[model samples]
Target chain A: MDLVVAVLFQLIYVIANLALISLGLAIIFGMMRVINLAHGEFLMLGGYTVVVATNAGVNIWIAMLILAPLVVGIVGVIVERLLIRWLYGRMVDTLLATWGLSLLMVGLVTSIFGASTATTVAPPLGAIRIGSYAASGYELFLILITIVLLIAVWLTLRYTKLGLLARGTMQNAEMASALGVSTSRIYMVTFGLGAAVSGLAGGLLAPMTGVLPTIGATYIAKAFITVISGGSAILAGTTAGSVLLGGLNGIFSFIAGSTFGEIALLLAAIVLLRLMPRGITGRFFRKSL
Target chain B: MNSGILRQMRPTFVYALLGIIFMFAAPQVLQLFTIINLTTAIALAVLALSLALIWGYGGILCFGQVAFFGLGAYAYTISAINFGGSTWAILMAVMITSAFAAALGYFIFFGRVSDVYLGVITLTVTLIFFSLIRRTSGPEYKIGNALLGGFNGVSSPPINLPWNPTSFLFPEQVFYVAMAALILCYVFAGWLVNTKFGRVCQAIRENELRAELLGYDTRLYKLGIFTIGAGIAAIGGVLFCNGVGRITPDVFNLYNAALTIIWVIVGGRGTLIGPIGATFALFYLTSALGGQSVLNNNLVLGIILIFFVLLVPKGVAPTIIDWVNARRKKAPGRVRRRRGSRGEGAQ
Candidate 1:
């Protein structure tokens, strides 16, 4: 009974982690139709923000929760204005351009931090005992925070004017413009919001996984898989895709070890994609957002 | 007036002639170290050519091209270690890699996976290969005599004379072979792009639905070109192993994959010669940067990519062709002739 509860907790954490990392990408891709390959780098930059701020004697919580997202969000706005603005509607060009941006970010960060940063930040909140098993209390905290973050995003998108306008712009930019909405400003804000969310996730994860310049490479693939599998619906698709894929990953990892676990996740995604080329949301929740 | 076939073949013939001359003359004029470096670049050029064919001409933007390259290298290393010769190993590598690509492409193209998802899927597959191969460090991961050395990589057998298996080719001889292979592949690709199949592939690239409506099987053509590209890239892997004398899981890394795409982009896609030129140029540029230790190679490459995409989207070859055409039009006789032709056409 204890083992079951422990596994269940771990599984939920996995799903939350997937959802957190993929949400920003989902917003950028789902809303904008701009496949920001640099989404991973935005996460990396967030991680670096935490590291830099913490090193400068800021509180860890403030660094991760506030500074990380703020810094990355500003960078995101700048990027949208400069790079992403021109490449709108050109999908393949966006892919190439953002890929170049990803490389540039990795290079710039590597040069500044010298390959890997010396991170002294460890997971806070200590460990929790789960009968025969002990789990990190920080993991539980992350899970809680992920839920809060998701709720916050859901509320913001649901209740806010910005969210409504952004959705309207995403659905039809010309129509939004015709209705006297500044579609460009919405795009810029939406992109920054996505980057800020990614930053927050990265800042939170930095304690768990040490920040390396090239670490974005590992996250980018998984985020892309989640977002792609999730399809066009921002919140529902991301949640559904994350739960399904992350649950499979967690279960497989528990049973077959990490290597097979990864292979299983990839195989599952490929098969899922084969069956539903437009993705899960494209097929099932055709009306859901 | 030039015949249709001859006109189509003219650029390739000229390039081939220059390549042959350079191949024979390079060893004499260049230092041994430079020749060795050029060998690696030549191998990479073949890989770039494969990408140029599939992504540029076929409009299939595969981000996992290194998977086939790495697989070919591994297959060659394992088979050579087992068979005690490279003659059969090279053939096996190409065949196996192409088969693998064919299977993977079947699922992707036939599944009607969108372009963005296709890129994501291919990249994910490449990462999977990287992570999977990186775990084979254990002693039990041996295939016959060759141990899958995991991240440390395995030393590959050099190509030997077909009759006498004992005598391996030296670095200089290997350089010659690499140059010859590059030239042959370039000519072959040039010939391919003019064929009826290539024309259909280009049409599919332009508009898949239109081609489909015309009764052409877009999926089959994509699969065919993808498999061929994989085969060519595998040959590149074999040559790469011969150049470096080793095979490692690093070949399947995201860096190499990105670098391959960079070569095609910088050199200009949709043209065989452009990527080849870009590969050699960027290869030397990175090597120079490595020597200097002043600027980061990735930063330089990133800037170049951005600059090209924003300013020179047509890439080097097409941009040059456009410039040359503009100059010719500005010439006195050419301007009058062109205007006269336009007037005649209007009439």
Candidate 2:
């Protein structure tokens, strides 16, 4: 049925967006051992930036490409320097501080933007017809862009000086520091990079999901669930978990309804966490941890 | 000579007595609105104490306690209206909420999940509960007395009060009930924390591997504590609905949970009275500032949280206690005697 296919396309879109968010979270949490609760808020800010830029008459795609990483990265750096720097080794402190920060940011945004959902930025005019099914050109472009970014990230991590240093730090911060690498600088930059990636994700998905102050809260749990289940393997695993969650969500929505669909997703993620403690792609990255 | 001991004892008794007296006498003098606000604060304080038990002592940070609060609220609304307008219906609601929390805790903590993941799991559970219940409340919400009233929620039937039972609560009676519950909860928690089970939990927090090596099952303790915490929070939620005479899904929002955590952290995690005092103080401040622009109210709270977290991470209670201890002058030649009595004197 048309409804079924439409739902399926929407599901794919959700998965792709979630994968992008989770991939960045995986790097920040999995690699750096920092739980940035405000990371989602960063995505929120980035999405708003793109929306504002587009409203000012900039080309939508160009606005996203230019503003997302830069704004998020700068915020990330400042946050690292001012707040997160003091919480380097303390997990609980970091959790509390960032939790507070998340609340503060959400409150500020809500006060400024009001509670109503923002109007979504329009997607570019284009549709690609495949057989009898038609898909938005924008959706296809998003998928392709994600794939390209994943590959590019993989290549960079596989072959680059900064990548090697990052890997070393990920394996062991103390040992890496002892090897004469500036662990402090790496931590700041790494956090910034993670935030930037999240921003990029927000910017790209703004057209699909829209720019709302509390929008991040909707996807954050799903993205976190995906990252936890995907294990810290690579972008592939994150994407795989994303599709698994997103597809299941869509299928369940068709059968049981949207509310039940979300409940099922939560239940499934909990079960997966219980069964696969190490996650789907956990084994591959075992040595790195 | 003995005055030092007497001086030290004054604050504890003074606070207790003042709390009791105020509970009885304040409603007589204050406006009706203030009385209502005070009652709400008591409910919120009780809820904060629940967080203190789980996060403070158990070292399990649950970010979704509002789920249980909401469940208890919804359960009470449904049961009270459907079954009967009796106290027993409310009790059943609280029990059901606890049972739900136990089932949730068993699945997450006993599943060998880490602390951070435990928080995420709890958040997911809360979200699921919110989404499902909000949607389901559409049609069958009202089954006789069991009507959910949809998103609007339900309230207790108004009845003639001996002395305005709903609002005034006969002054002393409601306050006594609150005080009794507080004392009972505090004593029970204190005993539990000093028990062998409590020792195992503390050990687990410090070193999970060593605790396991000591033949203690950490996961089971975590689950037990988490369930207890949820139950305690539900107890507070029940009181909250009764005091307010109504309930809504919004009452169980994530903001309430965050506020509870703020109370715990500011009060000093692991300290019982700290959370209680923090809750009361914060509510008092909120009440004072709610008259002003709402943004100013929130800005004040945000600033206080940021300041306390940065400068006094151990929390107001511990910091104050430390300051008081430092201010006391030690008796000359007492160092050796105190050192000898250190283990016993620690408490």
Candidate 3:
């Protein structure tokens, strides 16, 4: 019984982790139809933000919660105004430009920090015992934070004027512009918001994974897989993809190993894509946001 | 003189002539080390040319061209070890990698999925290869006599003269082979785009639905070009390891993948020579950067990419070509027929 509870916690943690890393990518891709290949770097920037802040003796929670997102959000806006704004309609160009941006960010961070092993940013939370197994309280907190983050995003998109304007612009930019909405501003803000989410997730992840200039490469493929596998609808598709892929990965990793777990996850995604090319929500939650 | 084919192939012949001249001249003038570096650059140029064919011409932006590339290297290494000959092993390796590409492309092109997601699928597959190969440590990962070597990577057998299996090629001889292969592949690609099949592929690139409406199976055509591109890239893979002396899973990493795209983008996506030129230029540039400590290579490349995409979207070759044409127009000459226009002529 304790084993099941522990396993379930592990499964949920994995799901939440995947969701957290991928949510920002989902928003940008799902809403804007722009394939921001630099998304992993955005997350890495967030991690670095927390590292830089905490190294200067700031509170870890405040750095992760506030500073990381704020810094990366600003970076996202600058990226939009400088690079992404020009390559708005060209998806392929957007991918290439962002890829370059990702590389640039890695280079900049490496030059500043000096590329080496992981930076130390230890989680402050203690382990919480459940029956025979002890789980890191940080993992539980991450799971709870992921849920809260998802809810917050949902409320923002559903209730906020900015969200509505962003959605309207994405749906039909010309129509939104005709209706007096600043589509360009919306694009910038939406991109910034996505980056902010990525930043928060990265900051949150800093304690668990540590900060590295190239650390984004590790999460990038998986995050892209999740977002692309989720399809068009931002929230529901992301949740569905995380639950499915993350669950499969967790169970397989537990049964076999990390490598096999990764293989299974990729294989499942390829097969899933073969079946439903548009992604999970492309078929199931077609009506949902 | 009367045939359009000869006139059409004049520039290609000129390119081949220049390549041959360089192949002969460079070894005499440059040091052995420089020649060796040039060999590596040539192999990468071939890789870039492969992308120029598939993505540039066929309109298939394959993000994981390195998957087939790495596979070919590993396959050649393993087979050469087992067979004790590189000639058959090279053939076998190219065939195997192309078959793998065909299978993967089949799943993608025929799956009725939107084409935009193809990049993600290819990248995912390449990453899978990267991670999977990295974990192949220990004695358990040996194929026949060759160890998978895990992360250490296996050294490749040198390409020997086909008539004499015992006579292994020196580094200089391998450079000649790499240059010869590059020239042949370039001419072959130039010839291919003029064929009916290439014409149909270009039509599909322009408008897939319109090509489909004309009763052409766009999927099969894409699969064909994808396989051919894979085969050519496999050949590049074979030469690349010979130049570098070993094959590693790092070839399948995102860096190499991105670098390959950078070559094509900076060279000129739609033109063959553009990417080949870009590959050489950037290859040498990065190699020079690898020697230095002051600047980060990634940062430099990133800036170049952004600069090219924003300012010079048409890329180096087209920009130069346009400039020359503009100059020619300004000079006292009749408005001659435009040689390399946008669509098929871009090659």
Best by lDDT: 3
TM-score, predicted candidate 2 vs. hidden true structure: 0.88
Window of ten residues with lowest summed lDDT in model 1 chain B:
B338-347
Clashes of each: 0, 5, 0
Q: Rank the candidates by lDDT, best first.
A: 3, 1, 2
**What C-alpha RMSD separates each model from the true structure?**
3.2, 4.4, 2.0
Per-residue alpha-carbon lDDT of candidate 2 for residues B41-66, written as tens digits (9 for 90 to 100): 77777788778878877888888887
RMSD of 1: 3.2
Compute the lDDT of residue A265 as modeled in candidate 3.
92
Report chain B TM per candidate: 0.94, 0.82, 0.95
Off by over 4 Å in 1: B1-6, B335-347
Q: Candidate 2, after superposition: displacement of residue A199 in Å? A: 1.3
Query: Candidate 3, residues A59-94: lDDT per residue as tens digits?
Result: 999999999999999999999999899888899889
All models, DockQ values? 0.72, 0.47, 0.72
Reference A-B contact fraction recovered by candidate 3: 0.72
TM-score-sorted candidate list, best first: 3, 1, 2
